[model samples]
Target: MRTIIGWAVLLLATAWVGAVEIKRPVDMGFVPLRAVSYEEAVELCTPLLSKDGKLTYAKIKNLLVIHDYPENIEAVKKLLAQIDEDPVNVRVDIFMDQAAQEKSSSFDVNLRNVRVEHRDGHTRVDGGIGISAGQGSREMSGSTNPFIMAGNGRPARIWVGETVADPVWVYEYGMGQGWWKQELVNRDLGVSLWVLPRVLPNDLVEIEVYPRVTARGSTPLSVDVKELGTKVVVQNGATMPLGGLDSSRRDAYRRILGVGSVFNGSNLSISVRPTIMRMPERLRQEKARQDQPPEKH
Candidate 1:
């Protein structure tokens, strides 16, 4: 009977030592970029200190408090491997929530164990675990068509416009009297035009424009155009020259007519327009409501 009692005490003491608990809070300074799951924490620290391995309790507490869990699992694993291989001068400890452990626990699987060891002039730690949840996926579809045109001599112009559910308009012409017109070809991507005459040679021509944009329940439509080769912003009410022309009137004329004696050239233009059909107010209101965050229950 005495022997049995002694054995029982010994077993209880062993269990108590093995079951030592560690609890500590982690601080991810203001605005944490990522949150780690519990399973990741376990995978990262398991090798440094096993279920029954020797470890400093304070070190374990520190690990739990500073580690960012699975979010930083990869980094934690690398650090562990380094410490393990150099245990002579390195130490590591980790603790995870019970819920995370339960979630990570699996049956009939070859559980990967963390490794720690010290080698010639170096320490190494290896292995990592991760946990993920609340993942989602989405897909979107759209298209765009951009076009360019050049001129050889005569004053040339091109006009292009688009008519879609919501359209935008853009075009380019000489800085002089004529304006180019662009026809909307595809309702989806907008329009394109290339006009070239057989004769006349001149400087390069350029134009840039944008379609008017308006939200479903918004007021008047607004347009924004980015200047070609420059950071200039041009709006609907602004008049922008297709390309800066030379100051000399004769030079400008020569540039417009193509430098060669008998000038001939081409012009390019483009435009985007929208064809919006107003929807029912009720439907619009419903859509707006759906876009808003749900109220607390």
Candidate 2:
């Protein structure tokens, strides 16, 4: 009986030691984020967390509070360091051109005894037809160049346009009398460009260009909006060209009992030039020194 009791106490002691050895103390780490947001860091660190790990954000100071194992904390730190990069600068130039075409001259003549024949997928006409040349010319319309700067995956936007007021007329019927009301509606017409630029380690830039144009529609009270967006990858210091936005203008005049029209049209092309501006090594070292906490006296 005494031997059994002694064995039971010894087993209990061994079990307690094994339990203590299996458990590990949770460690706390404070990490600073520069390029990426705190929320993004948490999202990235959540998957690598242990069962007892916790993450908190210090918004005022823009720091990350991590409570996890030492190895896990180190892993999170390394992951955040990989994505911390300098800002990207993009310059967008929009070019527009207008061309005017008018009916300069016309020739007409009566033709009789004309014969037409088709053979082997070809048409042959044995009659003389009137021919006239139309005059068409193009001129430089207008252009705009805008620059924007943003961090790694952030977006920057710029708007270049104008606001137009459209008049609306309404008729109301009163008791035995009719009245007309005139209201002015405001609209915006122009281009809105949103650019997202990402600089890779290999000196390549991935740009997302979203160009929206607002113009007048066919009807008086209607508005038209077109979104021309595309993704382009280009080398640093190179320009990427984007097209497909077209516009036109027309004016009419009354000439003593006749009306004439002057037509003008234009095509818009955009080119984006992205430049990666990295912080100098000396400046980076100075910034790091400034970010360090002051030593206690």
Candidate 3:
């Protein structure tokens, strides 16, 4: 009996020593999830989990279970606190200016049947017929400032173009009598602007802009398209210009009207301004006051 008691005391001491040597995982009790979904919270916390980390969720109750080392759990809590807030709303303002080459009524002057004579250091000039002819250009210029609002990380599109019917001719092969008929098909000719905005930290905005222009080609079946895509970062409520899309054509008139050359230009310029919705200071103060507990009598 004495030996048995001594052995039991030794075993108990060993067990206590083993328990002290082992470290238990900390359980950050179930926290109520508000703004973000359970799945999103899990995704955000997965990367911060250590080797022995464990996580679970109660979807019906909207509760998040996090179990890990004390430091990792704290980090996850901070992350959840940061991202579980109201969604951010962003508004994008787009300003577009399109100008096409405008040619004034061009005219040509010609001198014919001119006679000149010089006798005894005296110069004499005869009358000549002067002819003038002109042709006008058919181009237009316009400017538009269109503003659109969209949620952050979404795409907004604006189409400024026209649809026209195209003519198509078909021949009948089965019938002996040949028939000639024209069918009208529709075609779209215009410009489309797509803007995507993302709000980042530090009061900055990142924008993705895509501008496409389509026009009629030389042939009935041909079409011309011009596209430009770029990404830029700017401060909130600041405007940034889109570049690399300007074109000009020069028509040279050597002997007509003593004019050197005619400049015809088709220019496009775009400016983008992004504004993010933020909580007002006054409303925030009121909310803080309301969140406070009632005073005890």
Top candidate when judged by lDDT against the true structure: 3
State each model's CA lDDT, in order.
0.32, 0.66, 0.68
Q: What is the lDDT of candidate 3?
A: 0.68
Q: Give one digit per residue, the lDDT tens place, for model 1 in 1-297.
A: 999999999999987876653223332211111122234445655564433332221232223322333334445446544533201110101010111111132334232577989999798878765544443433322222332222221122323444445443556666686565655433322222222222211311222221222122334343333212211222322333333322232222332222332222212221222111234678756654543422435
Task: Estimate the TM-score for candidate 2.
Answer: 0.55
Highest TM-score against the true fold, candidate = 2
TM-score of 3: 0.43
What TM-score do all the candidates reach, one by one? 0.16, 0.55, 0.43
RMSD of 3: 17.5
Model 3: per-residue Cα lDDT over 1-297, one tens digit each = 999999999999999988774556465645556556777788888899787787898766566877778778888888888877644666777665555666566556667777999999999988776767676666565555666676567777666678888788987565567777789888777766667888888989998877666789988676798666778898998998755543421111111112122323445556778898766778757655553433435
User: How many clashes in each candidate?
Assistant: 43, 0, 0
lDDT of 2 by residue, 126-227 (tens): 876655545544343444455677665788766667898999888999999999999998988876666788777688888886766687899877999976
Root-mean-square deviation of candidate 1: 42.3
